[model samples]
Target: MLLCDTPNLVSSSEVIAGVSDHDALLAELRVDSRRPTPLPAMLPNWRRAPWPKLNDRLAEEMHAVLQINNLNDAWTAWKTTLVGCVSECVPSRKSRPKRRLLPWLDKKLKKMIKIKDELFAKWQVEKTLESRNLFETARRASQGAVRSRLSLPAPRAFPRRKAKRVENHGERRRQLAIHVLDAKSATGPDDVPAVLLKRCAKTLCPSLAHIFNLSLRACDLPTDWKCAAVTPIPKDGEKSDLRNNRPISVTSLVGKLLEKHVRNQLAGFLDTNKALPDNQHGFRERRSCTTMLLRTLDSWTAAIDKNSGGHVHAIFLDWANAFDKVPHQRLLSKLQHHGIDGAALEWLKNFLVGRSQFVRFGGARSEPCVVSSGVVQGSVLGPLLFNVYVSDLPAVVKTNLVQYADDCTIFREVTSQDDVDELQEDLALIDIWCVNNGMQLNAKKCVAMDLSRARQPRLPQYMIGGAVLEYVSTQRLLGVHIARDLRWNHHVDVQRKKAAQTLGFAARNLRGCTQRVKRMAYLTLVKP
Candidate 1:
């Protein structure tokens, strides 16, 4: 009964009577080759567009000031005009005689997948431990072969702000476009290429500014702009499971350009009001993993250098799905506390609420689902918003804390068992904070590392959410590994081996490529 009409799909059908005590039909399909995936007819060939004429047309149309009445209508009109200009200048991608196949799934990946299927069949039939293990190994290899390419509390009475208009947003818009709008970046769901915006920034800034000002002044975001196009990238796990993959969303880049402006304003407000603690090292200007590690290590070394046989007990807290679990109402309340109120706060509320996202892999797409919680995954403002959401986390932790966004490392200098008890109390308070804020702490992955030179080092147990944290003598903090003996040999060796393997892969594939390509390969693959 199994039939396949497609040329690429070669099918084999069989009937077996012994399988289920009845005649069972078995069908197998082999996709050895396929034609190129046809892109949506709407996506224009923007790279070959008449950019100068496009710019001139956009300028001529948008030179006049828009008389705004209804916000959505205005947005719709602008989008229509923008589309019209593009249609006139840019050629459709369908104009091509034949499109080439995408090279993401090659012969090697196909071969590995075939091996994995064979092993799976063997394991299913034999049902032995060794066979199962071999199957799992093959599954992991197939997964790897395909993967070679890719908080916070509400505040009480806060200041209500008078709305202030952005001054000279035209110039600011032009500057932001020049810096943040990358020509090479992916196009959003709107099918507008970033190259179009970046190249025509000079001519389009006025109209863009007008649109942006309308959004800010009216405290409204367009419906299309809020819809995110999500792309799921494989993570370090079995790729067959959806939960193991990471979702990176591509929201409207035009919306994101406005987000950048809002981000700057919000950051300035936080800095002026001192809302965030210095312990936060993620997403802030001039702070990174290395800086956070240096400070954490400095605190440990200082604690250890003291003559009282003082030891530092550190617990690295992991927030489970930290970005995805951010509550929108809680975030807005915190933003209000941080002096972002009135128009800015309203704009953010509109931005975060009623958003939808659809997952896209190649030419396929999932249905768009409404997002009730969490900021957009691959958004320009997600990190900053999360930081603001958990701004008060450091307050609850009584001991020394180093935070890089959600990855919090809490430690204390312990001279006696009483100090350990005090640190334990701090951990209890953090657990309570997570409960009150709808955040889950991954205590199973949490670890307590005691930094001491003493032969008889006291490593105490820590508990969060009734789960005991494991004790570890060696842990990787940031990218650098920390050992109980404070040696760098293991870390250096691991990095060396990783670099060598990556270099070999690059070299094997890049034999006939140019020197420039080889250099880029090294920089992107091996050097990093």
Candidate 2:
């Protein structure tokens, strides 16, 4: 969605106009309740072509071309051929099944609703006691039927519960705050269609053929094309606080596809060469954060089983803005040290330097700023690049290191003060490595937990950077929660409650849906 390099400044009046238009459309949808209205259609896919048919056409085009002088030319021709064929032959998907938000409205209910509306209309016009009574009775019957079908408790006037209305009002305020900037920026909902069209054209064209050719080297990237648009999202706290914001980059879809293609090649190369360390499970083939957590848990369980009374000191490292703060120069140096060179090294340098992004809050955009450090936040190459950047940590520190991306944990079997002192030395070595690599440990966020059958008579003081680490009874890694004692009870309980809440929402809204629909919704939303 971050397709535009530059955005025009928008006025508040233009935004208000769009919001008013949107509100009008929503109001129109709510006007009629007696008869079912046709559901709105899903947006068209501008780039979705019939792959089976298009592939044959593309093959014929490729076969007709006898010679390509440059690798860049070949890549450009291939992309052009694909776009020309696809743009002409793109097929439409089948229409989605119509859905009703209030699915419980049947013929009988519809009749009752119609009657209620008629009586209400008459009461409004006549302003008579008899007309009002008729309207009230019809409305009560219609409302009761709805409540009965949805299994909702009867409405009651509870003075104390009136306070809950404040919560609803607060939610409206939050939505308004999030949308105000967007509305004022003159970026309307129609921007998506325009962006998609532009993206399609850009992909089909050969403006960056040279960049695509560099992918053959599988180490480097193209120049200005690699810059990403960064947007800030609040990190689950008070929205007013700037500290709670985290920038997430939204890059070009075409660029992402190229990056993925290059990533696959580099991943294979790294795997075959065994250039990456085994301790690193991030962005590698057949490795994930979950896998890393399971391995760490396995090690913890094994140590506990081997020595019932022995303690394993587990310290989870937190780097402040790990991806955003990566020193580009240091990262490139690390890559070179790991044997990445030639066109690939140059490409990486071009990819990292002179990148500019403007933050977008709703529709309003800030002035363009240069990004001097870090990997692109949402880039496919980011995790792999980070892994390469920190791959030497195991060599730098003599301890059991388990890493999944930037979520690193180092632990050692501890008994006496000597063991604790040695662990502190290992921490210092890691800190030094981080500094050398243009990374800093967030000591405040970093946590230490002692895993043992029995508590040690004395606990060790752990310090990272200049700040001491806090000891926690439990911490969540990946999506799984782990207690100091390594019990699954906390995780199980949390998952169960979440599932119940999801199911409750599904049951309420999906009351009159078909059994098959209900089951599908449950499996898709609640089960996971």
Candidate 3:
């Protein structure tokens, strides 16, 4: 390609780049050496901050926030000192350019493209219409590659860092907790942003780590840490209706550093001792809703194949306000059963009890309400503690219960009518367990699903808490739609509609946005 009107046209030629074929050129060369892209303003790369200067400055003025008597003033002063120290000591560098994404193009497309070029060359040499038609056909054949690239997104895996046992385990935990604070997260009631704390983490970590360690030593946290500012977010329907919105508690951002550390220790202890059952997949590391669904579906498929024509009957149960219904006494008892006692257990007890919340709507805040039961609403330990609370849920069915947090399901291979009866008996046992634990299943919302090929003419009734469960042909369990006939048409159609809705919404609302931002619709397509 040549710029026909350009005055300084010394030379232009293609260079062999590994990314491109011999017949093609992927790189663009322009002799504009005099003009260079100006570097953007330098931002502090705190990850490589000067630690000696940071520590010295931090240690000097950080005492202003160490007053345990007035935590509110201390926290405010802490943020100020951190900001000062970070600005003074942290080094700044030119922002690095974002790495360009060049997803792989398959060999089949390359082969077809080569063939198309060959046919086009032949057509040019022989001046044959048939060769030209063959070249055109090969060009259209590459649309499959285009569609494949657009429709399917390769799953990206991130490498995880594991904890190593060091001499100062407590110090290490505090450092990590402070370090991993989400930079973009919304701050809690204290008005001190997590992002601000994160930026100064290098300078603030040692001092923060010491404060956290003191809390652990005495097995007691500050009152301010236990306090939360609750904000009601609309879950569905009208925003004006308070019932439609669920309370999302925002505990102190500073407190989260301590909370996360304790949560990790408790989780690690549970994982090491294997206190949590295989059935309970809630909040545990390396376990997710997808894994739970996979394990359940895999076992059901195996059972069906082994029995030659077997089907699995499953009942999905939802607990009413499960997170808010966990009794403190019961949770402590369960923790004790799992062999967590002495200082560790005492720390957990203090962590749980004496927690209070006040709803914040607009400018005014409601009176602080003392919460007696259930775990902290928005804390890191909430779900883990909830999972532990119901860890002893009966796994009476053959499939040994599939659970993710409060979502519970029990399934078994139904060889005969007796097998279905056995499943009902298991459900009865679950009802009894729920009653004992001060937790009851929302029987009205409970649904029964049959993962079977053939539909039974008269499906047997299943009961929980004297309420008959409704059976559904297609039930969505943990985000994935499960059909009795095992077809993905409904699931695919639903997702396609959602993506279309999202795309349409973006296009309509983002008319004022720049091209780069408007291109988010394309990224949204690849996101799912």
Candidate 3's TM-score:
0.69
lDDT of 1 by residue, 97-191 (tens): 34464355677777888988999999999999999999999999977665453201112233475654445765864556555566788888876
Per-candidate TM-scores read 0.77, 0.66, 0.69
Worst 10 residues of 1 by lDDT: 149-158
The most accurate candidate by lDDT is 1
lDDT of 3 at 351: 86
Tens-digit lDDT string for candidate 3 (460-482) = 89999999999888888888888
Report the lDDT of model 2 for residue 118.
96
Worst 10 residues of 3 by lDDT: 1-10
What would the TM-score be for candidate 2 when compared with the true structure? 0.66
Off by over 4 Å in 3: 1-58, 64-176, 238-241, 306-309, 395-399, 455-458, 507-520, 525-527
Query: Candidate 2's residue-wise lDDT over 10-128, tens digit each?
Result: 11112223444452211111122353344445433445645456545655665433255454455556556655665566654545545555556688998999999999999999999
The global C-alpha lDDT for each of the candidates, from Candidate 1 onward, is 0.80, 0.68, 0.75
* Clashes per candidate, residues 3 or more apart or on different chains: 1, 4, 0
Most accurate candidate by TM-score: 1
Quote the positional error of residue 516 for candidate 3 in Å: 6.5
Q: Weakest 10 consecutive residues, lDDT, candidate 2? A: 23-32
Top-down TM-score ranking? 1, 3, 2
Rank by lDDT (best first): 1, 3, 2
Error of 3 at 11 (Å): 79
